[model samples]
Target: MSPLSLDLSPDLFPALTEAQADPDGPGAHRPALHFGDRSLTYGELAATASPLAARVAEAGRIAVWATPTLETAVAVVAALLAGVPAVPLNPKSGESELGHIVSDSAPTLALAAPGTQLPPALAALERLDIDTSAPTTSLPSPGAPDPESPALIVYTSGTTGPPKGAVIPRRAIATTLDALADAWQWTGDDVLVHGLPLFHVHGLILGILGPLRRGGSVRHLGRFETAGVARELSEGATMLFGVPTMYHRIAETLPDDPALAKALARARLLVSGSAALPVHDHERIAQATGRRVIERYGMTETLMNTSVRADGEPRAGTVGVPLPGVELRLTEEDGTTAVEAYDGETVGEIQVRGPNLFTEYLNRPEATAAAFTEDGWFRTGDMAVRDPDGYVRIVGRKATDLIKSGGYKIGAGEIENALLEHPGVREAAVTGEPDADLGERIVAWIVPADSQSPPTVDELADHVARRLAPHKRPRVVHHLDALPRNDMGKIMKRALTHD
Candidate 1:
């Protein structure tokens, strides 16, 4: 293999150009996306992207609150090829919130499927032409575009409250694709199974960009159904990138289908991200599918910085070591940054400096500045510790996800894990709520398993108190039918806190 090219000269458009040419060929006429009966090939995707790119060029800044379908996928790429910043908006956001985002972005155009309600302001713009037909020719090769130009504006998960858009430059895409092409072994020969939502960074960048840039085909899912995913695996797609929830759901449905096991066995890689991959789920997937999930850590601000590989033993409760071109550092509680990796028990703020980090939050200069340290490393608000083997375990987020009671820091993730072990619990989200005497207290919102009653707060607290330190046990619990999850299936802790 050729030495890894670190020049970073190739932008997304140029990368697409390369994908269109060479051994993979610019116009292979092979499949680009498949969701149920719809299958788009490279040539057709390029054809559709061209006119849409032309439309985007006319609009300048285009935002899409599109449903997670094949059309939404191609429209985003088309906007990028047109040299515009495409912001993927959640389809489930309310009109008030959608109006706010549309008004803030002030997009020149917005695309929506028929009958889908779009903000009046966005509705005034030209609607995207829905054409699932294949392209007549591959995207034309063009001169290298500016590598530093803004490619897309991705929003934060709003872990705190309202989501903010983070401006990711063209270089960010190139950097991620290059890294994954080596790190994750993406190549022309691979086909990725994509069950992630297009609006989220994991699904948009890593799920879409990384695979296409390397000339590999992507088989998409219109909606994530366990049976649909099982079907894709059975179809012989060699790779997959999905959130932990997707893996868990698939594990739930796969045990009854031997075909699912056979298909998963044929896959060369399976990755979990967007949220923590529980230690049990990690082991469960490996045991059930005969393939260990390559768990990694990343966020909307940065596309991807670290990964555990297909060749490595996936460490339970940890997101594997940093990927190439990623620099990891730990700042101690006293404000000293530790250059060396810390043991698994030592807690510190996780910092990363890498090519994949976003340029800035679109309009929030203060938020952008606050996101990084003095020397420019992005201060990942996550608290983590690196074990002796260099695997990084995410202890908790620095925000509300940490429960502080009796003067001890307790990770909601740990408590959530303990709750999930109970046979009665189907899902859970742990949060810290204001408590007069303790400053803050642990509270759990649980989804009870089918035909089983939810465990009482005292019962869960007692169960946790047996395994965890006294201060780590929950003080309150509420039983619900399901935890509120976002479009990507990540538990909405903010919503839980609001409730």
Candidate 2:
């Protein structure tokens, strides 16, 4: 059986198309984007982007040098307008990684803002310098692209090997954004603010495209700052989107900065994703600002699966319920779906099937086929437990987060959260090292609140045993200045070792 074709709205980006068709509409004067001092109204965006899209549409595939700039946003908007698949390249990627992406994606052209220098990896492709203000062409109906056609080929982090491209279809984008609108009660009246990068799903799709799809406005901080976040929220930005790191910083500074707390309090919605906002930070922010930050669960392949809804309970340590159109379930290791009354203690791999899912892994048929179950559900490889109320709390990754010890399955997240509750512990990560007695021993990595007087292994171990179970306690402890983290604030557990 073939996958269902999206066939949602004829135009993938209905709001932008509406602006293009009627430049003089009532909301035409409203800002579509705000980056630093630069701005683009919905009407202006349509006019500027449609003409440039003519150049982009001609390419079989295009590579976008995704920078945190207005020009980058315009370039992507134009790609969608022209129905061309745009592959966003992270500027921070090393030469080898960039080379691998360019060679694998095989783009006919590369795009970036005028005067932006090009790296050697992008040199092979014909480069087009985008000048947003200078362009002219008759805009076509955005229904040009087939629903199944790839809109973006977003590459994975390639932690295990060379990066594989996830071919996101026009259908996935529309389905996801629409589902989010329903969950968030979002509308044209809302204004969003974020300072995330452009290459990833959290920043580009949810942060930027999500607003555009809803006819709402987005204000990008260009670079994240505590002051900028406060300023935007104080100036009537209704929603704030950020990763755990940004929220952590806000939590840290909220005591001394009443302005930041005030700003967060005024915002209608405060969202955190990309990584779990530590329970410690969550409690601190809620206590100081009276605003509980909501967390959403998503991936590069599946744009967004679940979220804590606006009207729902703002539950900490959970990713809330599945979106309106998404179907999510937990599966045991043997491919059996767990439908029993969930006690929120038993962990299983998350499997989902929905219109919001990506079409394929570009050029990797084997990997793509292996990623889905026999019944067509996507294997997320994320360990999570669903509460009876249906909120899903992710424990950790199946490959890294699950620790098998003395006949029990332990989730590193629960232990890390437990360690964070300790007054002397600032940050923590847990991993299982080989042990002759238990098969695997839990090892705890700690960034102590006071390095000069770090907590003893016995003290921290006893702390965990008391909070959770004794078997979950760390068998060994190592002190570090800081835990290794990725750009998104997810700790790199693979980097840690017993030695």
Candidate 3:
């Protein structure tokens, strides 16, 4: 089939017209989105959005700063139809990070929820107060989007340094949604529960676009609330997508929720990505919800490459096989072939080339060039291996998450994943510390499951000894209530490494 045949068309907002045609489409008045008490139907949603998109066109870039809601999704679609790039910033981000993003994007217009505080940078931009109460001008009719036109600019998680906006083309958005929907088996009958941040690709494309394209119902939750999530699932949802931390919280808080557990048993699918899922947490969520959590692999650079299936047994640590149309490989820094087979235990840097990959980093030509191999695969910067079944298991970040201790190279994720398996441990982070004799030694910072019964150093050491190789064990263990993480729930290893 031709590539365009798989495209996601902004011009076709069936949820908009379908609501008008039937006035009572599947999600018409059936709680399409809930942020606190505010609710909007499929019909009411399209009406509020069409005019706001026109106002967004007057500005060069539309910066959306609001708590996640169906309303936020409305604004995003309106901005795209209006033919301007949408820049969604994290409302909970520190002023410094927010300022950096606003300065980098230089939005022509800024929109925020009624009483939201704007950073100094966004405050300086022209503001268009959109009244959802009044009918505004409709978006100017347009032809097919310019294949190269920028639709969205998603910033990286900044694991390396400051985050840069990666320019995603209009075509790339459609490409990613098409690939994800097919791989994840999304259908019009599905009701997807969305909880990830709108600014990140893991949420933007996967949480929102992937479901919308399939004509599925998207139920938006403003943020992760263990109680609220259980309530939503009890109300009826077929699919759930979240990060590792979210699953951990749900597993911890809903041990006795039989109704919610039953709902999970009935749900068609469960998904986790954007970060690694510890084997214990994976098993806990599955056993609690009675459904396997399908873990996937992808990044902002390449929207999504692989996923474990809902029906398949989630191999403890693997991220699963590559999505259709995506080609993957492992290579050395010098660009030569590093590995040839899916050995289940080998490790190397992961790379991919596919229709779903992004066009470029906004203006960083050097960074863009450096991100790809000479053979044209986008370097994922992740160290991983494929199993005999072609399932991909992520080891750690190639540059920073790998620690050299004694004469062995160790994956920090390997230790962290094992540590999380202990019933007493709530969370864990492993980093290499300088050693006078061994050159480097493993140090673990753990968050205990119970504050009153935090494990002793000896207990933690014994736990690691049983789960890891002798050389991979931690020499020092420190207990902390919680580990530091960014907006996307990725453990801030850089901070631990430096501290």
Off by over 4 Å in 2: 1-7, 134-138, 141-143, 337-341
TM-score of each: 0.89, 0.97, 0.89
User: Pick by lDDT: which candidate is best?
Assistant: 2
Instruction: State the lDDT at 72 in candidate 3.
Output: 62
What is the TM-score (0 to 1) of candidate 1? 0.89
How do all the candidates rank in terms of TM-score, highest first?
2, 3, 1
lDDT of 2 by residue, 45-73 (tens): 88888887877787988999999999889
Each candidate: what lDDT? 0.74, 0.88, 0.74
Would you list the clashing residue pairs of candidate 1?
A: 20-25, 20-26, 21-26, 44-134, 44-135
Better candidate number, 2 or 3, judged by TM-score: 2
RMSD of each: 3.2, 2.7, 3.2
Residues 1-499 of candidate 3: C-alpha lDDT, one tens digit per residue? 1122465555435555565455445654443444556655555655566667656666778888755865567777777667788888877777778888888888878876665667776778876654544242233333445756888888886667788898887777777676666766676777788678887787777777666556666777777776666677777778888998888777766587776677777768888888998888778777786677788988887888887765456676888877767888876545567787777555678889987788888768999999887878898888886788788888888877667778776778888888888889888988877898877888988889898989887787788888777777888887776788876778887676443
